[model samples]
Target: MHSVVIIGAGGVGSVVAHKCCQLPELFDDIVLASRTESKCKRIAEQLDKPVRTAQVDADSASQLVSLLQREQPELVINAALPYHDLNIMDACLKAGVHYLDTANYEPRETACFEYHWQWDYHQRFVDAGLTALLGSGFDPGATNVFTAYIAKHYFDEIQQLDIIDVNGGNHGYPFATNFNPEINIREVSAKCRHWENGEFVTTPPLSMRAHYTCPEDVGTYPIYRMYHEELESLSKHFPSLQRAQFWMSFSDAYLQHLEVLSNVGMTGIEPIDYQGQSIVPIQFLAQLLPDPAALGPHTQGKTCIGCLVRGVKDGKKRLIHIYNICDHQACFREVQSQAISYATGVPAMIGAKLVLEGQWRQPGVWNVEQHDPDPFMADMNRYGLPWKVTELDPEFQLDTEEHQATNAVH
Candidate 1:
C-alpha cells in the first residue's frame, strides 16, 4: 500500500482522490490539501473511503515542507496550479518524498511555460534519490506518452508531429475556461512557439489556425496552433523530430470574450491599483467567472485528443494517430468533474501509481515520455482513458487555414 498527498482540491484534485480511492489496494492512504481547507474537505466527502484533508499555502515552500513532514507520504501528487510546481518539488526534496505534477512550472509574474525551470532540478533529485515526474496531465502527460508509444511501436524514427486536440463540449457559458482562467488566458495570449527543422520558431499567439475533423463523429472544429510545454521535452528526447507543433480548439465566443478582456486590460498579469489596493486583473476576473469544478453538472459533450506522427518505419515512410475520446457527462457521473479534469486527473493517478509500483521510480526529474510507454498505455485502458490508434496515409498533413471557436487541447 502507498500513501499520497494530493495538493490543490480543484476538479482535477477531486478526480485524483476519488480515483485513488477506487483502487484501495494500491493507494491505501490519501491526503488532499489546498490553501482552502474547506475545498479539501469537500473533495474528501466525495470519495467513498476516508481521505485526510489539510490546509497549506501552496505558495510557501516552508508551509508545504511542514505539511509533507507531517504527512510523510510516499509521493506528493501536485494537482495545484503551475505556479506552485517548484514550491511543491522543493518541499518534496526537503521531506525526502517523491514528486509528480500534471503541469510544468511557470512563474506567477510571467506566463513563461518552459521545462528548464523544473528540468534544472534533475541533478538535485538524483542526488537526493527522490523521483520528480513532470507533466503527467493530458497534453504534456497523455499526449507525450502517445508520441512516445507511437514512436516505439510504429516508427523507426519520427520526423514530423502534430498534436491535435479537439473538445466538442458545450457548457452553455459565454466565457469560462475549463481549467484555471488565469493560466488559460495567459497561455493563449503568450507568444506561440513550434518546433520546426531543429529549432523553435516563434510567432504571434493563435496566429496559425487549422480545421480539424475528429474521428468517430466527435464533430469538426477549428484548431489554433499554440505553444505547449510538451514540445520542449519531446524534441530534446527525440532528436530525430524535425518538426513538432501543438494545436488546440477554441470557440468563437470564448475568443471574443478573451479579445475584449485583453483589449480592456482585464487579462493583464501586472497588478494595478484598484481603490487603494493592488489587484491583478486576471485574478480578479477569475473570481467573476464560473468555477470550472461546477461546470461538470452542466457540461455535456466529448473531447478528442490525439497525436499525429509522420516518420520512417522499417525504412518506409508512415503516419499514425493515437488518440483518446472522453465524455463530459460520463466523467461527471463518476468523479463529479468535467472531462477536462477527468482526462488530466486519470493520467496523474496512473503516473503516481507507476512511481509507487517502482516502474517509474528512478531517482531524477523526468518527463512522462522518458519512461516506458507500455505500462502507462496499458493503465489508460484499464482505467478510464482508453486510447485508439489509426494508421493514416504517409502524406497526412495539418493544413493551415483561418478558423474560429472551441476549447481544450489541454
Candidate 2:
C-alpha cells in the first residue's frame, strides 16, 4: 500500500485528494494537512474514502518535517501555496520521502516565480535518493507534457511555441481570482517575459495581445502573453525552442478592476504600516475576495488550455495543436472545484500517481518535461482530463498584425 501526505486544503488540494481516493489500488492511504485543521476536515468530509487530517504551518520547515516524520508517507503532494514549496521540499528531504508540487517556488516578498531555487536542490535530492517533481500543475505540468508528447511524435524540432489558456467560466463575481488572489494578482501584474533569440525579452504586463478562437465552440477570447514558471524550465529542457510564449485569456472587466487595484496600491506585495501594524495590501485584498474553492458551485462554462507548436517534421514545416477542454460544472460535480483548480489539481494527482507507481520516480529535482511524457499523457486520457490533437495548416499562427488590428477595434 502506497501512502501519501497531501499538504494544503484548498481547491486543488481537495481535487487531488478526491482523485487519489478514486484509485485505491494506487493510493491506499492519504493524509491531508493544512494550517487550519478544520479546512482539512472539511475536505475530508467531501471524500468517499476516509482521509486523516492534520495541522501544520507550511511556513515552518520544522513543523512540516515533524508532520512528515509522524505520518511517514512515501510521498508528499504539495498543493499548498507556491510560497510554501521550498519549506515542504525541505521537509520531504528531512523525512526521507519523495516530493511533488504543482508550482515552482517563489519568495513571498517577490511576485516572480522561478525554478532555480528548487532546481538548485537537485543534487541534494539526488544524494538522498529521492525524486523532487516540480510544476505538476496544468500549465507547467500537463502543458509541459503536451509539448513533449507533440514534439516527440509530431515535430523534428520545435522552434516556435505558444501556450494558450482560456477560461470561459463565470462565477458571477465582478472581481474574483480563479486561484489564490495574492498569487494571481501578483503574477498577472508582473512584467511579462518571453523567450526569443536564446534570450528572454521583457515587456509590459499584458502588453502583447492576440485573439484566439478555441476549437469546439469553447468561445473566442483575448489572450495576453505573460510570464509563467513553465517557460523557464521548458526552454531549458527543450533547446530547440527559439521562441516560447505563454498566453492567458482575461476579461476586460477583470483587467480593468486589476488596473484600478494597481493604481490604488491594493495589489502591492510589500507590507505597509497600517495603524502601527504591518499588513500587505495584496494579502488583505485576497481576504476580501471570494474564496476560489467556494466558487465551484457557482462557476459555469469551460477552459481550453493547450500548446501550439510550429516545427519541422520529415523536412516539411508542421503546425500542431494539442489541448484539453474542461467544463467547470462537470469538475464541480466530481471534485467540488472549478476548472482552474481542477485543471491544476488533476495533473498534480496524475504526477503523484506516476511517482508512486515508479513510472516517473527518478532521484533528483526535475521538471515534468524531463521525464518520458508517454505514460503521463496516457494517464491524462484515462483520468478525467481527456485531450485532443489536431493538425492545422502550416501557416496558422497566434501573433500577427491582423490580430492586433482586430483587438484595437474592440
Strongest candidate by lDDT: 1
What candidate 1 gets wrong by more than 4 Å, as runs, is: 402-410
Per-prediction TM-score to the true structure, in the order listed: 0.98, 0.97
lDDT of 1 by residue, 1-410 (tens): 99999998888898999899999999999999999999988888788999999999998988999999999999999999999999899999999999999999999887788999999999999999999999999988999999999999998999998998888999998889999888988888887899998899987778789889999999989899989999999999999999999999998787888888887888888899989999999999999999998999999999999999999988999999899999999999999999999999999999999999999999999999999999999999999999999998887677787444222211
Worst 10 residues of 1 by lDDT: 401-410
Predicted candidate 2 versus true structure: per-residue lDDT over 68-146, tens digit per residue:
9999999999999999988998899899999999998989987779999998999999999999999999998999999
Residue 174 of candidate 2: its Cα lDDT? Answer: 98
**Per-candidate RMSD vs. true structure?**
2.3, 2.8
Q: Which pairs clash in model 1?
A: 249-406, 250-405, 250-406, 251-405, 251-406, 252-405
